[model samples]
Target: MSIQDYPSRLSDPKSRKTETFSYLPSMTDEQIKAQVQYIINKGWNPAIEHSEPENAFSYYWYMWKLPMFGETNADTVLAEVQNCIKANPSNHVRLIGYDNFAQSQGANMLIKRGDM
Candidate 1:
C-alpha cells in the first residue's frame, strides 16, 4: 500500500490498534522510582505507584522488550520522573515504562485505575 493509503496506525478507543516499539531501554531504577512518584503526586492512582524493588530494574527491560512507545526523548522524561521519585521517597511508586507499551494501553490503564 502507498504511504497515503497505508492508514494511520494510531489507536482508537473504538478500535484497538497494534502497538509498536523501538527496542530502546531508558531510565534507571532510581529514575523509574522517581518517575513513579512523580506520576503519583500528580494525582495518579496509588496502585500504579505500587511495585517491587525489582520492578524498578525490570522497568527499563520491560520497555526494551515491548514493541510500542518510541524511544525518542523517553530518557528525558525518565530523568524527570526520577527527580520526582527522589523528592518523594516515602511515597511508594513505580514507573510503568511508557516506551514498552502502547500509549493507548497506558492511557486506558491510567484512566481505568484512576491513576490520572
Candidate 2:
C-alpha cells in the first residue's frame, strides 16, 4: 500500500524503500563501477532523481540534472554518483541510465560506498 494508506503509528511492513539494489545486499564499488561502464558502453547517460513532496509518500521523482552522455568514462559514473549523493543526502536518490535509441534503465540505491 502507498504511504498514505498506511497508518501513522508505524511504518509499512511491505514498505520497499529502495529498488534494484537492496540495503541487505549492498552493491560494491566495483560492481557499481562495472554497471556504470556497461551503461556507458550502451551509450546511455547517467542521471539522478528524487522526490520533493512532503509527508514522504510521493513517489514521483524529478530529474535533479539533465542527462549527461558526453563523457562516457567510468570516472563520469562515479562523479554523477557523488554529485547525486551530495545533492540529495536525506531524500531518496536513484541512478538512471538514459538513452535515446532505447528506453532508459535505472538502478536504485547505488550510493552505498560502505560495503557490498
Cα lDDT over the full model 1: 0.34
lDDT of 2 by residue, 78-108 (tens): 8866776677665555567777666646334
Off by over 4 Å in 1: 1-71, 97-116
The C-alpha lDDT values of all candidates are: 0.34, 0.59
TM-score of each: 0.26, 0.65
lDDT (Cα, tens digit) per residue for candidate 1, span 1-116: 65443343334322222222112233455654554555444443222233223232233221212222333344454454455455544332433433223333232111111111
After TM-score superposition, what is the CA distance of residue 5 in candidate 1 from its true location, in Å?
A: 52
